[model samples]
Target: MINIKRLTTSDADFGARLDALLAFESAQDASVEQTVAAILADVKTRGDAALIEYTRRFDGLRATSMAELELSQNELQAALAGLPADQRQALEAAAERVRSYHERQTLESWQYVDDGADACGTLLGQKVTPLDRVGLYVPGGKASYPSSVLMNAIPARVAGVAELIMVVPTPAGEHNPLVLAAAALAGVDRVFTIGGAQAVAALAYGTQTVPQVDKIVGPGNAYVAAAKRRVFGVVGIDMVAGPSEILVICDGHTEPDWVAMDLFSQAEHDELAQSILICPDAVYIERVAASLEKLLPTMPRQQVIRAALENRGALIEVRDLDEACRIANRIAPEHLELSLADADAWVAKIRHAGAIFIGRYTSESLGDYCAGPNHVLPTSGSARFSSPLGVYDFQKRTSLIRVSPAGSRILGRIAATLAHGEGLPAHARSAEYRVDG
Candidate 1:
């Protein structure tokens, strides 16, 4: 059963328990670092040979060359055909929504600057260029997440990434058809049958077969997360995602069953997944707890939900809506579902969250699919700083600056003065040259 706590108590010591419930900080031990470093070193030295060896050891499959890992067009088509019509339609629809939403996030090159003289206007702008290649990592251990494939690849495609590669682990030497079909829908360029720390290494430091990518994005298990952290300096990453988390802010007016289901939606992800509820009414907490108990047995993933709820789930009673809002902001949850009657009224109060589901009808699952928002979000407490994955993740911005004679003269004195103040004489001299020329 989910732990239920009353908020009416005046005890200050309750803060400690609340902090413990909110804590999702990664436990970085030396072993994780050592293991990841060994994997990286192996890939760096042996290249394709190391990837093959690691694949055999971890993924329980044998593939000597990168050619064996690459999926053929026929294989992708076959996968799509194998899916039921309804499932296929869902994937296609979700892909369209994901692509449409991300297309809006695309940026274009722009310039803005003017000086008095005809040839003196400075050209100050930013160039938005897509990465030459990108890699998407999809976990395949617990279950296949086709949604993840669409969420990661659609945004990259929309951003005009030239080469979009996807990697997933399959022990049976078979790829999940649903995953391949989703990849097809999202226009993924290549699909590889590889996973774990070694796969990340192959992507970061290209092998004979797998091309090195400018950026790597997607969610994975602990080993995969550790690998991303190790390769951070070598290549860009979306985020070192932690466990899944969802927070629900509900009023007594909302149905307890609806709130419970929303909580279960996240809790079913893994035992480390956190599902939290904050409400002013103690009666709501009791009702939601009862609903969870009633619904747990009916769920196919009941064991997972049970373990997750036992480990990281909580139901907190707050003094009022304002306190509930403050608590939600402090936690900075990945998926925040505002189920209050007047959800829009409290939207301004939420300072941090990866994605906000604004009404009772808008559940977190909608955002995970056709809600037109990127499902790949900053997990754990990263919502406090990082943002959801989008087109920006697949593009790099470069500043463009052109100084004309008159423009340089107008700006040079201040630049020289600032450079000189910082003890950079060469910088000051360079600016002075432009002004005097």
Candidate 2:
């Protein structure tokens, strides 16, 4: 008896209805933005004192000093050792897979002579380098995702980030061993038990104890998102992601139960998360809906799943798989699953999507955990312009240019013309100097 929306391509208003379903606004409250601005200003001025005070006021941790909140290397190692053998092995295995996959994405510096473009042997290329340091924020409390630790930290490490600092909230001074273990395995250089806007400020501005990071990455609540938005130019950010999304295109060949569970996987994320199904078979869509109603009650997060499905979920009856692909291209979902038997054939049809899961057996959840790809993806139609978090996110590029003496004669004249056209006398003069020398 879920109240999910049902639609068909034959409907005249199908396009408009679909747009309404996919629309999302990530804007924050004015009050939240103002509060974040104050907190950032306070942290920028007071440094460690502001961090300590906020940690006490917000997290209820009345620590005497900042050192007390910092986790030592020994503590991280002990957390890894304390886990059950099976859990430790699984964590290690996932880390290895993630690390191995990101190794291939590591960019290297390269240069080449522009002999074709210029006869004077002018050199032009690019230099790739990783950020010197990066800060990672993990949401704490009842939810603890060690997977996020590996997803965010492993890429920074693989990109050769010199120091990786992690901040997680420890309300009442309680910590998650699994989180610490993942941090240890991912080679995080530091750990602090602080969160919210204050943690972001500490990483962004640096305190007496916490070192400044070149870029900050990870997920958090509204305040964290607000803080990252406020400090964007000061530091690099991964993305202010929206709700989790999954668009499944089934060919009516996949099992009904499997399709139902696939929708649940994303709906379970939260109430605003979206789960949509596009199929040519109207009866198969009904079968999946029935399966959803029947299997939903068994889930521990049943109420959350129900809310998400009833509010944002949809089942669209398309003319065929080609129509399904066209609709999916419009959605530009964060996670896309091609549940067709010949999933690979349709891959070329998909041009947008943060990550693509091929085949019925390849559930989006696999990409979330041990799938060897970074689970952090662009959300809320951002896949149209952005991409999944990878080693490239933590790395930067610099353009390389060198002009030979012979090259300056021709290059200088071209530069001088452009500079004069732009009305910049100094630029033209500088290029003229190179030509004369």
Candidate 3:
């Protein structure tokens, strides 16, 4: 029997216990930071030489030239062709759905001419444009996530990003066919076999061969995360994700096995990932615990699931569904599943969550793969302010302001007043020059 924490809202110390359970300090190792800083500086200084050296030292892949590491258009298509028919169909179908969904999120430029006397026919609005280039990082070796390729690349494509460069480390010159195939389908402009801090550095600061990207997006291991954190201001990055999280609110109507596996789905990611069940029915919670004991024995990643459950998982008994929602909003989990008869009705009660998986049949895994929303979600309580990655993330918006002669006089007077109050003489003079008042 696994040891999962049990809590009840009626307990006097429930709030404090919940706080202890929810705390996850993501502090990076000081040694890792120092090492990342050195690597970044080396890559910036040495260029292709640093890349070639690191690739050989880390991946044990001896490459004479940068050209040798790049995957050609032909190779990408061949990987796609080589896939089993079923795999190919699934990938393509998922890609299409992701593409279709993100198309709706594409932002367009808009302008409006203000006719107010202060405006003097000034045209003011915003211009939305696609990023020039973006770099995507995919983890390689034993872990193969073609789904990540589809999720990250498809959005940039939908947003009209000009060039998409992908970097995946091929250990000992061995590559994952699925990843390359997905890249091909997603229309990635370039592909390189590079990983670790070097890949991030090369993308942030251009080398002789690899081009600098406006933004770098995707997932990686600890070293890669450290590197991304180090080079944040130099280039754009998607969120530095925390462990996968899922908070399931069941109404005792959903199957016990389903609830258990739903918890397991997130827990199986790693030892730190959290899986929680908030239900009003105490008996149903016990049944779900029983389901966990029986079903955990069958899972291939049972050790990991067990560790995650024992360490961070929880089953909470609330007075009612309303109480469960209150706790959920406080936690602000990454994946919030409303496994209730009236899932639709409770949507209004939810104020914070990365992605709301409604109804019993809607698995969080579906949203991770083909459910069409970008699976890249805010984690570790970041859902309180952030959002899922989308086409809008790849598009840049510029404020448009055209001050007419009449508008300049009216606006400059106000600007000069504020600037003078702030003791900015230069600013005041700059605005006063245009102000007729």
Candidate 4:
């Protein structure tokens, strides 16, 4: 039997135990940071030469020039065309749903005249604009992530981003067709077969072939995360995501096997992933534990699932559903499932969560793929302040201010007073210059 932690809310040490479980040391390794810094500086200095060298050294894909590493539009389309009918249909359907959902999130420029006592007839508002170019880094070796292409690229496209350049490491010159196909379908402008810190650097500081992008988004290994962290101010990046997580609040009515499998879905992502179950029923929790024991041997990725469950997973018995919701707020999990009979009623109680999978039928896996919502959610308790990746992440908002002659006189005095109080004579004088008696 696997050893998943069990917690009871009534215990005196419950809070301390919960805190211990939630605490994950996220500091980057010192060696990884040092290596990333060196790689970033090298790429900034050598450009495409550094890229070629890194590709050969790390990915074992020997190439003479940058042109040899970039994939043509024809190749991308061919990948999409060659997919089996079912895979092709699924990709298209998921892409369409993701596109449709994000289209609603597009921000438009708006302005209004301010006719108040302090400022009369002053035009003030916000001008929304999309990023010029974005770089998407898709992990490409052992596993495939067409879903990530749709999640990251579609939002940028929906926000009217001009160019989307994708970089995926094709180790030993092997490419995942699904990723390329998704790129073609999502309207990516350019595709580069590069990986690791070098790919991030090339995108951040523009090489001979790869154009500089305003932002870089998508998932990668620790090297990529370290590189993104190092070059944050130089270029925008999506969050340095943690392992996958799922918090299921079942009222014990759902089938035990179903609950067990739901936990396994996130656990199979990796050993660091967390899967927690909070219910008011004790016997029901035991049934679920038995189900986990019975089902473990059947999974293809059983070792990973077992490790994740033993390390970070938990089965907590709360006082009631209300207590469960309160605890859920404290944890602020990435993916929360309300598996209660009255799941809709409890949604109001959940103020924090990257995504809430409502009802028993709505699996967390659906949201990861074709659920009409971006699966790139805030992880590691970041949902408290951050949000899921969307078109908003790709759009910039600029404040628009047009001071009329009458409004300038009224607003100038306020500005001058404040500037003088702050000991900024230049600011005061600048505002005074625009003021009239």
Candidate 5:
């Protein structure tokens, strides 16, 4: 039988226990950090030569030149064409759905004239523009995910990014066709068979062949995470995410089996992944536990699921659904599921969560693949302030200010007063110069 924590809201130590479960050491190991810093410096100095050497040493791909390490558009399209009919259809369908959803999120430039007295006719607004180029790092080999390709690349495309350069490490010169196919479907402009800190460095500081990108997005291992963290200001990056997480708030009306599998969906991601269930019904919690035991043997990734559950999974009995919502806000989980009979009613109660999956039929898996929302969500309680990756992530907003002569004269006195109060003589003089005599 699997051993998972059981908590009750009435217990005096419940808050402490919950805090312990939520705490995770997100700090990178010193050795990993040191190694990443060295690799980043080497790549910055040597450019393509460093990339080639790292590729040979780490990926065991003996490429003579940067050209040899890159994949052509023809190859990407060929990958798409070669997929089995079902896989091709699924990829295309998912891409279209994702594209449609993100199209609505595209930010547009807008301006309006100021109407205040003496400040009238001054134009102020925002100009929204997409990044010129973005680099996407897709994990290759066993962790290769075609879904990630769609989730990251499509938003950049929808935001009108000029170029999307993708880097996936093809260890031993092996490429995952699904990833390439997804790239092609999502309109990625370039692909390089590279990985690890070197790939991130190449993207951050362009090599002979790889053009420098404005931002780097996607997932990778500890080395990749460390590289992104090291080069943050040099280039923008999507969040260095924590492990996958799911918090299911069931109300005893959903099937216990359904609840158990929902928990497994996130737990199967990795050993550090967390799966929790909060319900008002104590007996129903036991039913879900039994369901977990019964279903564990049938999963292909049983070891990972078991480890994640035994390590971080929880079944908590709350005083009521209201208490569950309060706890959910505190957790701010990456994925929140309302598995209640009246799931829609409880949506307003949830103020935090990267994504909210409503109703029993809306499994977290759907949102991962075909549900049309970007699966790249804020993890490790970041949902409290952050949000899911979208077209907005790939767009930049610039404040637009155009002051009329009348408005500048009126605003100049206000600026001069504040600037002089801060003890900046130049700023005061500059503003006073624009003021009327």
Candidate 6:
């Protein structure tokens, strides 16, 4: 049974409990660390030979050579042709929305001045160049999420990425048609039949077959995440994501059934996924709980949802909406749904959250698929500092400084002084040489 707490009687104590409940501590078991390290070391030492072995062991498939893993253009086209018209149309439409949103996020170079006639300036800008190559790891464990392909690949494409490579595992050495169709719709340059830690290793430190990528993106299971974390120094990664989390703030005006269903959306993702409700009214909580009982039986993924809620979900009655907003900011959830009366008014109070879903009509699922924002978000309380995967992730920025002779002379003394104060004569000498000469 899900626990319910009232904030009125023990305001401070209950608030602290809420904070403890929401905090995402590193709960990784020791075995995961050992396993990940072993896998990474194996890949580093054996290279392609190790990857082939791991692929067979984990994914139950064999790739004797790297060439067998790569997907051909005709194969991708056949996958798209095989999809029903409705599914194909939906994928294309979602890809367009994703493209449009990320296009707006593109940044350009700029130049700025520091002083007057003795002019010192810096080219203060970011070069929105795309990654030469990227790998998108789509999960093939319990189910297939074609939407993950679009969400991960389209941003890279809009950012002008040269090559988009996708890797997914197949149980019977056969890729799902839906996954292939999504790859086709999102303009993935290449597709590969590989997964788990070995796939991440192959992408980070290229094998004889899989090309080395500048960065890797998309969500995966624990082994996949651990592999990404282990290989982070070799290449860039979006985030070391945790399980899915949804924090919904609701009022008495909304229907109970809608609230329960909204919570269930994230809960079904995994057994550790969290679904929280922070509201002021007790009557609304009761109604939502009853509705959850009614709806849980109808869901095909009921077992997953039930375990998630029982383990990590909560319903807390706060003093008022102001307190609710404060708690929400502190939690910094991956997905925040404002199912309140004046959702817009509360937007200003949100200092943290990977993505905000405004109003009753807007669902978190929309953002996961057809919505204009990228779905690759920071999870496990990382919303406090990190951000969603975007066009900027594919690009790197380099700072340029241009100083005239006069500017150099004017700035050299300060540089020398600071360098000398820090007890570094070489640093001082380098600046002194420019002014002296």
**lDDT at 385, model 6:** 94
Give the clash total for candidate 5.
0
State the number of backbone clashes in model 4.
Answer: 0
* Per-residue accuracy of model 4 over 1-437 as CA lDDT, tens digit each: 99999999999999999999998999889999999999999999999999999999999987989999999999999999999999999999999999999999999999999887777899999999999999999999886699999999999999999999999999999999999999999999999999999999999999888999999999998999999988899999989999999999999999999999999999999999999999999999999999999999999999999999999999999989999999999999999999989799999999999999999998999999998999999888999999999999999999999998888888899999999999999999998998954
Off by over 4 Å in 5: none
Q: In model 2, how large is the Cα lDDT of residue 154?
A: 99
Query: What lDDT does the true structure give each of the candidates?
Result: 0.86, 0.93, 0.94, 0.95, 0.95, 0.83
* lDDT for each residue of candidate 3 in 334-400, tens digit (9 for 90 to 100): 9999999979999999999999999999999999989899999999999999999999999999999
Off by over 4 Å in 6: 1-12, 113-128
Backbone collisions counted per model: 0, 0, 0, 0, 0, 0
| Tens digits of per-residue lDDT for model 2, 173-282 | 88999999999999998999999999999999999998889899999988999999888989989999888999999999899999899999999989999999999999
* Prediction 6 TM-score vs. true: 0.94
Per-residue lDDT of candidate 6, residues 1-437 (tens digit): 44433344246577577766666666776898788888878887788888778878877776787677778988999999988999888888988999899999876666576655544652233344567899899987556889888888888888788998888887668678888988888899888788888888888988777789989998777888888988898899888888899999987678888889999999998888899888889888888988988889999999999998887888878778888888888889999999988799999999999999999888899999999898889887889999898888887766657776777777888899999999999999999998897
- What are the models' TM-scores? 0.95, 0.98, 0.98, 0.99, 0.99, 0.94
Scored against the true structure, residue 9 in model 2 reaches a CA lDDT of 95
Model 5 lDDT tens row, 54-111: 9999999989899999999999999999999999999999999999999999999999
Q: Choose 1 or 3, whichever is better by lDDT.
A: 3
| lDDT tens readout by residue for model 1, 325-375 | 888888899999999888999899998999999989999999988878898
Scored against the true structure, residue 90 in model 3 reaches a CA lDDT of 95
